[model samples]
Target: MKNFNWTNIRLFLIVGVAVFLYSFSGIRNEGRKIKQAEVVFVDNENFITKKDVNKLLKQNFDTVTGIKKVQLDLNKVEKSIDTNPMVDKAEVYATIDGKLTAIVVQKKPVARIFSGSKSYYLDYKGNEMPLSESETARVPLVSGSIDRTDKKRLSELLNYIYDDDFLKKNITGLAVMPWGDIMMDIRGYDFEVVFGKPINIDRKFKNYKAFLQDAIKDTLTENYKTINLKFTQQVVGTKK
Candidate 1:
């Protein structure tokens, strides 16, 4: 019985050793292939570039200065890239040929703001980004009290601007009042909208549209300083 038990133990050890050698050989072959393989594919739409990945790898691998190993934890690298504010999403993977690939998606900016001694851009998710001076002037400005509350208001206003095609083209600037009132300066019409309170905003916007349409059709020479829509049910225009 003792001899039988010893034989079983010896056989188990032999099997384990064989498995370990097989795995080790496979790993060594993989490493060699990875070292030899060049970048097979890069998803350009991904916010992160190949240069970014290379830079990150170099920075993180500096500790192993002399090592020629090219193995990478794709999940870890993708996580690092996704942390960037401009990157909406990122994915990393290795091809069958051992080439590393990364897919990145960039965040889209919805509106731009120039307030409090600095100009910034905001994404659709309301994240603020620093404005580049070299960027072309395309976004509308939000003037007035642009604090936390007003920031939210600005986002809402942008939604309205996107929905209304006429308003999108006609509006050139926005001025915020101390009491959270919004004043819009329309293009080419020589008139301003005194949008008091962000309440019933959609209704007030419709009213303004109706009034403008009527004025255009009638060809009336009514020079106005302010078109008040505080009470959306009632519109009052002050002549210049």
Candidate 2:
């Protein structure tokens, strides 16, 4: 137009650049806030509760003295959890927004055995786990001469216990004889099941079931002292 004001123009351009930079910085911060991650979900089942998982994580990770950051290595944590005897498997994942998730499966106890100083928990697969004090009362106790129970025989006995519903419920204790015979103390009826040898327990259980179905109708006014299922396919009982 009239005279070009170079100084004013330069000043205005500088102001504009500063304003744009400030606005861009604000936008960048807003984007970061929008993209922030959150803990979205947790799945707990089969004796592996969310609380239990959290507790374990805290015990292993959070309690570490030098861990300045809360960066979670999911694979490492999952591997650590799998080492537990009760944990069958464990998985950990992170969501798109950065939420962490954990899933776990726990071992089921088939029978709890008490050997002298310590207790052993036997799973359905016959894997032995250390007995926890908190779980002592819930599972049935296996007492008497547990030292005589070798791995093979224990596995066989566990298989028998898992298959027979009556034995699972009624049998309270197990005593292993020197000759590999098993004596069981049952509940409800006042009798012990003299189950000889872990071999052919299925047949013996079937025989016992058949006999009780007929005999317990009115014959057991009191209780049976012992029901021997040792010889052949017969169920021999002694009255209390």
lDDT of 2: 0.67
lDDT of 2 by residue, 46-76 (tens): 3444555566555555342233223556678
TM-score of each: 0.65, 0.69
Residue 108, candidate 2: C-alpha displacement in angstroms:
1.2
lDDT value for model 1:
0.65
Ten-residue stretch with the least lDDT total in model 1: 35-44
RMSD of each predicted structure: 6.6, 11.2
Name model 1 segments beyond 4 Å from true. Answer: 1-70, 97-101, 148-150
lDDT of each: 0.65, 0.67
Encode model 1's per-residue lDDT on 1-240: one tens digit a residue.
Answer: 335688889999999999999999777755643432222223333334455545544555553223333456667777876676656666766654545555666655555676788777676567875554334435567767776345666677776775567777778787777777888888887778888766677898989888777777887426777788888787887888
Candidate 2: pairs in clash: none
Prediction 1 TM-score vs. true: 0.65
